[model samples]
Structures are given as C-alpha cells and as structure tokens.
Target: RDLCADFECEPAEFNGAANHVHLLVNLPPKVALSRLVNSLKRVSSRRMRTEFPEPARHYYRANTLWSDFSFAGSVGGTPISVLRQYIEQHNRPV
Candidate 1:
C-alpha cells in the first residue's frame, strides 16, 4: 500500500470487516506510530473520497474517515503465528 511505501514499512498481513480494518505492519524503529497512523488515515480518506465520493463526503464532512481515537498495541512478546490467527479469526463470519 502507499502508506507502507511512504513510511518504508512492510505490511505483513491485512484484514477487515465492514466498518474497520486490521493491519499488521512492520515498520522501522525510527518511524513513530502516531505519524504512521496519521498518514494511514489520511491516505485512506483520500482514497475513499476518490473511490466513493458521495458517502465519504456526507459521512466525513465534519470529521474524518477514521475516528480520532485508535487502538494500537505492541506485540513484542507475542508470536507472529498467534497474532495472525487472532486477526484472521476476527474476519470470520460470526
């Protein structure tokens, strides 16, 4: 994705539902999470506006495509396999 290329990060995995997405990104230590997140939100918003202008314009007219708050957790201690499984599981039909 453009976000990864701009930030010099790699997307190890990606998944999503109707309202949200999960991205397992591998980025450099020098890149701050806040900055990356801001870029991600910006890029996503731009793409949404380009791809689906009507809804994005209506729903995000006042705010943004993403919430002001974001949930970010470090997985320094978690195994990649487990993380992959957990993320994959969330995408399954409930």
Candidate 2:
C-alpha cells in the first residue's frame, strides 16, 4: 500500500471491517509523526480520487475525513520492553 511504501514503514497491526480501519506502525524515530500522517492522508486521498472518482467526490462531504486536530505523545519514560508488551497486548483477544 502507498502508506507502507511511502512512509518506509510496515503495518505492525491491521484489523478492521466495513467502514473503519485501524493501523499500528512501528516507524523509525527519525520520521516526524505529524509529517508522516499528513503526507499519508494527502497522498492517499489524491490517489483515491484519481482511481475512484465517485467515492473521492463525496469523501469530504462531511467536511473532512480527518479533523484539524490530532493527538500525540512521547513514551520517554516508558521502558522499551514495557512499551513493546503494551503494544503487543493492545488489541489481542481478551
């Protein structure tokens, strides 16, 4: 997918049905999160429009696919081991 290819990252986790998609990416520290998300959104939207005009035309009828705001945080104090475990268990069967 363009998201994986363009970002130089792999989708660590992917699970969704019908309307929504959830993705987890283990990206490199060098990649700016904001820049990466923005680029993915911009490029993907454009490509989708070119490939599927109908959906693209009404895609933003609700105003925008995403809001003008986003949430971000650093795991500075979290241990690598702990973080990995947390991510791994995040969406696992309960």
Task: For residues 29-79, write the lDDT of model 1, one tens digit per residue.
Answer: 998988998888888888888999888877685667777878776679788
Candidate RMSDs in order: 2.7, 5.4
Which 10 residues in a row give candidate 2 its minimum summed lDDT?
A: 14-23
Give the C-alpha miss distance for residue 11 in model 2, angstroms.
Answer: 1.7
Candidate that would win on lDDT: 1
* C-alpha positional error of residue 64 in candidate 1 after TM-score superposition, expressed in Å: 1.7
The regions of model 1 sitting more than 4 angstroms off are 92-94
Model 2 misplacement above 4 A: 1-6, 16-20, 61-66, 71-94
Residue 12 lDDT (model 1) = 82
Candidate 1 backbone overlaps, count: 0
Local distance difference test, per candidate?
A: 0.79, 0.61
